[model samples]
Target: MPEYSEKVMEHFKSPKNVGEIAGADGVGEVGNPVCGDMMKFTIKVKDDRLEDVKFLTFGCGAAIAVSSMVAEMAKGMTLDEAMKLTNKDVAKALDGLPGNKMHCSNLGADALHKAIEDYRQKQAS
Candidate 1:
């Protein structure tokens, strides 16, 4: 097994914002079929800011950790700011992820960005 960071373990053990938001302003889901890792992110935006964020993830410890960390980081951020959040930033916030599992960080950010895009699309329509 990979030696995960303490922060990773912490997030996995007790992930924050773990559920979905009913009637959420936006929602996005992504998965790696080969790896069987999946994530769903939901958001509530207000005044051009992400007032709330949540996620449901199924994967390894790293995936769960990334999901939790991303929600926390994106909350209260403007839509543009959240969109700029990269996988590197998510990994750094968790104190870094094992190289073999770095892709989990990518999934986390991708899911969030997709959700943000969904929100924007809905607003524009």
Candidate 2:
């Protein structure tokens, strides 16, 4: 049993913001090949706020759903607020994910944080 809800299946089947950004301020890619899950997240930030987010994920239904939800949640949020987003937040936004799929949410949060960090580093330079 995949433990996926209808919403999760819907998102997975038709993910939103499923592409790369042109001139993205930051891009982060993470994956566990052993698990066959990979996600690439691109972000554009302006005035310390997330102007946009997009993702391309190669994984299971849970991974796609998490990635889509992460992108939707991160956009229009300040960097500080986006950084505060945790796996729990993503899971909660999706109405809770399966225990085994928890790592998918973790991947989304980690990639978003990494992208934000990358943006900060570029701005510092």
Candidate 3:
């Protein structure tokens, strides 16, 4: 088993922002075939800021914890600021993840980025 940090366990056990936003401004979904982890992030943007963020994750504890961390980190951030978020930042925030599970953080960041991209795309149309 992976040696999980206390923070990771805590978030996994009681993940925050764990639902969907109705009529969300944007939605992003991603999955890893190897680990069979899937994540979906929904965001509400107001005045170019992430007014709210939420996620629905179907995966292991690490993935769930990453999703929660990403949501918390991105909330209230400007679209540009949220876009700058990276997987490494998520891992570091959690105090680190097992090497094998590091990709979970990537999924979290990617999901959030996709959501932002989706919002931008809508604006362009």
Candidate 4:
């Protein structure tokens, strides 16, 4: 197993925003079959900002920590701001992820971006 940073372990042990948002404005789901990791992010928006963010992730400690960190970062961010969020940022927020588990950060960012996309699509309709 790869060594994890203290922040990663802390988030994995007690992830914030761990559940789904009821009647969420947007939801995104992604999976990496090669790594058997799955993630779903749900969000609520208000005035073009992410009013709330939550996630349910099934994967290793790194993936869970990534999801938790993503949720913490995206909440209250403007849609444009959240859209710019990147895997690099997530990994940095967690201090860093081992090279092999870095993909977890990618998944987290993708999931949040997709959720924002979903919300935008709804608005456009």
| Candidate 3 wrong stretches, greater than 4 Å | 32-34
Write one digit per residue (lDDT tens) for candidate 1, span 1-125: 89999999999999999999999999999996577789999999999999999999989999999999999999999999999999999999999998989988999999999999999999999
Best by lDDT: 3
- Judged by whole-model lDDT over C-alpha atoms, candidate 2 comes out at 0.92
Worst 10 residues of 1 by lDDT: 28-37
**lDDT per model vs. reference:** 0.95, 0.92, 0.96, 0.95
Candidate 3 lDDT score at position 47: 100
What CA RMSD would you report for each candidate? Answer: 0.8, 1.0, 1.0, 0.9
Error of 4 at 66 (Å): 0.3
**Candidate 2 per-residue lDDT over residues 1-125, each given as its tens digit:** 58788878878888898999999999988997787899999999989899999998999889999999999999999999999999999998888898888989999999989999988899899
Q: How accurate is candidate 4 locally (lDDT)?
A: 0.95
State the lDDT of candidate 4 residue by residue for 1-125, as single tens digits: 78999999999999999999999999999996576799999999999999999999999999999999999999999999999999999999999999999988999999999999998999899
Candidate 1 ranges beyond 4 A from true positions? none
Candidate 3, residue 89: Cα displacement in angstroms equals: 0.5
Per-residue alpha-carbon lDDT of model 3 for 59-92, expressed as tens digits?
9999999999999999999999999999999999
